[model samples]
Target: MLYYEDLTTGRRFQTASHTLSEDEIIAFASQFDPQPFHTDPQAAKTSVFDGLAASGWHTSSLTMRLITASELKDVANGLIGMGIRDMRWPRPTRAGDTLRAEVEVLGQKPSTSQPGFGVVQLRWTTLNQHDDIAMQLETSIWVARRPVTTTEPA
Candidate 1:
């Protein structure tokens, strides 16, 4: 399990690909986002996207799923999301678009008020099959530090 001390600045981890199916896209949008561009294929043709596209929220949720399945699962304290910033969807995520994530550790600092805990900043970028960036965000998390161990007298 990775602890705060194990995370290095500029370290990157890649997650497995997730293929966005049309049904999945529509279903997610219908429940959470529910926009014409995301739910109704016929109506989406007249929207700015010009066709069916996944909602940004759906993309973000998928990213969370990928992170949990890939990176966060092994973390000792797991990950406590402090906040998120600079969220942007540069390109539309359309049906059949296979997506993968690259998560980079941007920085880390020990918590001033809490020992054995630290804060980490990470940049997550999701790319499509053609390598176009579909979504990007910066997030902060609180991670537990590795316990200090000392040899016992034998």
Candidate 2:
């Protein structure tokens, strides 16, 4: 596992592509989001998106899956979601659209109160098949640092 000291500002990781299916979109939306654009093609055509669209939550979930399947899994220091900030959906993600997540390390700070933890800020941008950004957000997570051995501490 990568510790806080191993992370650097501006480091980036790309996740594997995930294709959205109509059934998956509707199923996810029906349970959580329940928006016209996400649930029905006909309703979506009149709603604004012009066709079936995936829910933002579904998109976020897919991104998380991609992150876990990538090299980030090894570096992750136990995710502690502090909540997202400035999240925006610039475009709609439709069925059959392949999506990928790119995460960048924006900043990191050693924990002042905790000896073996630190805070890391990350920016996640999701892009569709056409390489257009569909969603973007900033998040902060508390990560564990590599423990210091007795000899190393001295």
Candidate 3:
């Protein structure tokens, strides 16, 4: 299990690909975003995207899933997300687009007020099969520290 001490700045990780399905895209959008570009094909054709696309929130959710499923599955304490920043969807995510996630440890530091815990700043990026970035976000995570051990004097 990875702990705060186990992570290093500039370290990177990647996740498996997830192929988006048209049904899933529309279904997710209908529930959350409900925008024409995401929920209606014909309406999307007239929208700025010019075609059906997935909601930005949906893409962010998928990115989180991929990260947890692969990138941080082995961590000692999964994570407590402090907050997200600089979130952007540069390219629209469309049905049939295969997406994968990448994680980079941008910075880390021990918690000043809390013992046995630390904070890590991470940059997450989701890219398509063509290697174009679909979405990106920077977030801070609370990480646990490894337990201290002491041996009796012999």
lDDT of 2 at 59: 88
Backbone clash pairs for candidate 3 read: none
Candidate 3 lDDT by residue in tens digits, 1-154: 8898877899998999999999999999999999989999999999999999999999999998999899588778886899999999999999999999999999999999998999999999999999999999999999999999999999
Can you tell me which runs of candidate 2 are displaced by over 4 Å? 151-154
Worst 10 residues of 3 by lDDT: 71-80
RMSD of each: 0.8, 2.2, 0.9
Candidate 3 residue spans exceeding 4 A from truth: none
- The full ranking of all candidates by lDDT, starting with the best, is 3, 1, 2
Q: State which candidate, 1 or 2, has the greater lDDT.
A: 1
Q: Give the alpha-carbon lDDT of every model.
A: 0.93, 0.87, 0.93
Q: Could you tell me how far off, in angstroms, the CA of residue 141 lies in candidate 3 after the best superposition?
A: 0.2
> Could you give candidate 1's per-residue lDDT for residues 1-154 as a string of tens digits?
8999878898998898899999999999999999999999999999999999999999999988888889667878887899999999998999999999989999999999999999999999999999999999999989999999999999
| TM-score per model over all chains | 0.97, 0.93, 0.97
TM-score of 1: 0.97
RMSD of 1: 0.8
Q: Model 2, 150: alpha-carbon shift in Å?
A: 3.9
